[model samples]
Target: MSLLVVGSVAYDGIETPFGKVDKILGGSATYISLTSSYFQKNVNLVGVVGKDFSQDDIDLFKSKDIDLQGLQMDESGNTFFWKGKYHYDLNNRDTLDTQLNVFEHFNPKIPESYRDAKFIALGNIEPSLQAKVLEQVNSPDLVVMDTMNFWIEGTLDALKQTLKNVDLLVINDSEARELADEPNLIKSADLIRKMGPDFLIIKKGEHGALLFTDDEIFSAPAYPIVDIFDPTGAGDSFMGGLLGWLSYTNDLSPQNFRRAVIFGSVMASFCVEEFGPDRLRDLTEKEIYDRYREFRELSEIPEVG
Candidate 1:
């Protein structure tokens, strides 16, 4: 099975209590593709970069065995650049600067080879663009889309239109509450399910993640980490891990979905251990599975038999 990811690939300048980096390999698609590459062999990436995006960065994706046929390069423009600083607690962050540049014109064109991708992941981008991706792909088995509050508020019509085609909707708790206009998550999930997707994943950051369907709800706790250096790209990494495992197994059962969320948390926990995708770049299957085991043990509440 193959997976296709459509999102931004750009440069990021990050600052945290640990240290600061002027520019590094970063973007929703970059993190998602890197994390997903660990679980699946064929990961087709679709995004745009500019002349300023270095060849070394392009090589980075190739090194991960990520297919870049759909990756576009705009020689005349600069790559999207974002500068952000994280709070000491690592829960909240402030965006210092954002330059959309080439990404502003990113119109994803799925390569002919990727048109039949079994699984498609639409990273946090405009809902119209996410809908456009679905228009190009041939009957994907699973369609997962991630969004933020920006689109939920500014483009509700387009967001809801895109939702109709998505199999799973992944968004954080705040976005969920705002989207459904309900304070209660369970109620919010119910309202969201009516909008489109059969499944909804409400990410609660370090608190954990929740998965809800029409008939069932599954909760996955976040892996505990004493030191979280940077929280950037954690959510995308989570999505990558979740979709990567599911794409590898080609299983959509609720039980399997529950496991996928745990694996996602596992990957996300590792993401915050270092800045950008440095930690995930060199991760091995053994390490991922070992963490998965820890997650299982942590959540396992044995019955008093």
Candidate 2:
């Protein structure tokens, strides 16, 4: 199953209680594609970067064997850049600066070779842009889209329209609430499902993530780690691990979705242990498998008669 990921690929400056980085490789597509690559090969990436994009980063993508055919290079200006500082709780952040640069005028021109992707992961971006990506690709087996409060507050209508075509919607709990205009998660998920997306995932940050379907709901628990270096890109990494597993197994059963949720949690747990995607890179297959088993153990109390 071919996996196509579309979103921003840019430089990020992050300041957290644990550590800080002035500039590093970071973006929704960057994290999603890299994390997914561990599970699926030939992961296709579509995003724009300026001449400032580093060769090491390019090599990093190639190291994972991620396909970069859809990546665009605009030498006219710098790539998208964002700087933020996280509070002690690591839940809230203050945006210090944002430079869209080439990403501002980004036009997702899917390559002819990538038009037939099997699984599509749309990262957090403008709703209209996400829809444009959908329009360019052929019918994919599964379409997963991630959105944020920004789009919910600004482009609710367009977001809703795009959701109509998406199979799954991945958003934080607050964004889910904001999008559905409901307080309770269960009811909010129902309202959101009615808009579109047979499946809805509400990411609850450190609390874990919830998966909602037409009739079933699965709650995945978070991995406990004392030291969390950076929370940025954790959600995208979860998407990567999730869609990556789905594409790798080509399984869409409700039961399989449960496993995918756990894998998503596993990847997210690793993500916060290091800055950017440092933890995601250099991960061994055995490490992932072992951690997955450990995740299972977290709630696998022996069946009590």
Candidate 3:
């Protein structure tokens, strides 16, 4: 199965209680494509970067067999840059700096070769940009999108327009509440479903994730890890796993959907083990399967008399 991921591709400087890195290959598309590559063979990336984007990162994408036909480069500008520091809990982070150089005017242009992608994952970006990308693709089999509070509060109408096109919407607990203007999660999920997207996944960091369909709901618990690390890109990684699993099997059955959520949780558990994308850089299929079995064991229920 082939998958297309559209989002920022840039450099990130991060600090956490575990450690710090000046700059590394970090972006929503970067993490999503890399994580999804484990399940899907042909992962496509669509985003813009500047001259400052490293050759090493490009080579890394090439090594993963990620199609970069839609990855645009602007020689005159610098790549988007973000710097942040995580609090002791590794959950709360403060954006110390943000410079949208090449990304400031990013206009996602899908190459003719990439317009037929079967699965599309729209990372956190302006609703208008997400909508623009959807316009270029030939009706994808599945469209999953991630959004933040910024778009919900600022460009609501555009967000709703974009939502009308996607199959699934992924957001954190707070964003779901804010978007629905409801305090209770069940009510929030119900309200948001009316806006668009028959399927929604409300992510609660460390707690777990909840998947809601028009008729059913599934909750997957988070994998417990003793040593905490950076939480950046974890959500994108989760979406990658979920989409990757579904794309790999081309199945949307309720059972498959439940398993996909587990796969997503497994990928996210590995994402937070290190800063940036370092941990995912060396993940192998055997390691992924091993962790998946462990997750299964964690979620198994015992029979009662």
Candidate 4:
């Protein structure tokens, strides 16, 4: 089973209490493909970059067995760029600047070969653009989407339309509440389910993630880490790892979903340990599973009153 990812491929400058990095290779699809590559070899990436994005970055994606045939490069413009600074707590950040450049006019064209992909992960992008990718894919078994408050607030109608076409919707806790207009998370999740997706995943940053379906709810806690340099791309990394494991195991059952959440949390913990996408870009499967084992051990506790 192949995984198809659609999102931005950009340059980012980030500042954190730990340090600062300027113009690093950072983007949602980039992180997702790189992290997911550890589990699934055939990852089809669909996004656009610009002339300034560098061939080295493309090569990096190729090294991970990511198929970049669908990744377009606009020779006329520069790739999207974003600058942000993180607070001391590492939980909140402020966007300093954003330059959409080529991404401002991004029109993803899904290749014919990529149409055979069984799993499709639509990273945070315009709802209309995500809809266009879905229309192009031939037969996708599972369609998961990630979105932010920006779309929910600015493009509610489009987001609602896009949600109806997806099987799973992934968003952070704040986005969930903003989208549902409910302060309570559980009720917010319920409202979102009514909007569209059968499965809703509310990512709670360091607290962990919560998965909700009509019949059940499962929660996974984030791994305790000593140091976190930057939290960028952590959510995308988690999504990548979760989807990668699911694709590799060829299991979409509830049991598999539960396990995938743990795998995702493990992957995310590694992502925040370094600046930008450094840690996940070179992650090994052994390392991932080792952390998974550690998480399992830590999570298992004898009956305690």
Poorest 10 consecutive residues of model 2 by lDDT?
A: 295-304
lDDT of 2 at 284: 91
TM-score for each model: 0.98, 0.99, 0.98, 0.97
Pairs that collide in candidate 2 are: none
User: What value does the lDDT take at residue 257 in candidate 3?
Assistant: 87
The model with the greater TM-score, 1 or 3, is 1
Instruction: Point out the higher-scoring one by lDDT: 1 or 3.
Output: 1
- lDDT of candidate 1 vs native? 0.93
Give the per-residue Cα lDDT of candidate 4 at 28. Answer: 91
The 10-residue segment with the lowest total lDDT in model 1: 213-222
User: To one decimal, what is the Cα RMSD in angstroms of model 1 from the true structure?
Assistant: 0.8
Query: Candidate 4 — which pairs collide?
Result: none
* Tens-digit per-residue lDDT, 118-153, candidate 1: 999999999999999999999899999999999998
lDDT pick, better of 3 and 4: 3
The full ranking of all candidates by lDDT, starting with the best, is: 1, 2, 3, 4
Candidate 4, residues 155-237: lDDT per residue as tens digits? 99999999999989989999998999999999999999988788889999878899997789998877888788899999998
TM-score of 3: 0.98
Cα lDDT tens digits, model 3, 1-305, are 68999999979999998899999888899989989988998899999999988889999899889899889989879999999999998778999999999999999998888888888999999999999999999979889999999999999999999999988999999999999999999899999988888899999988889999967999888899887688888998999899889999999888898889888888999999998888888899998989889888888899999
Q: What are the clash counts of all predictions, listed in order?
A: 0, 0, 0, 0
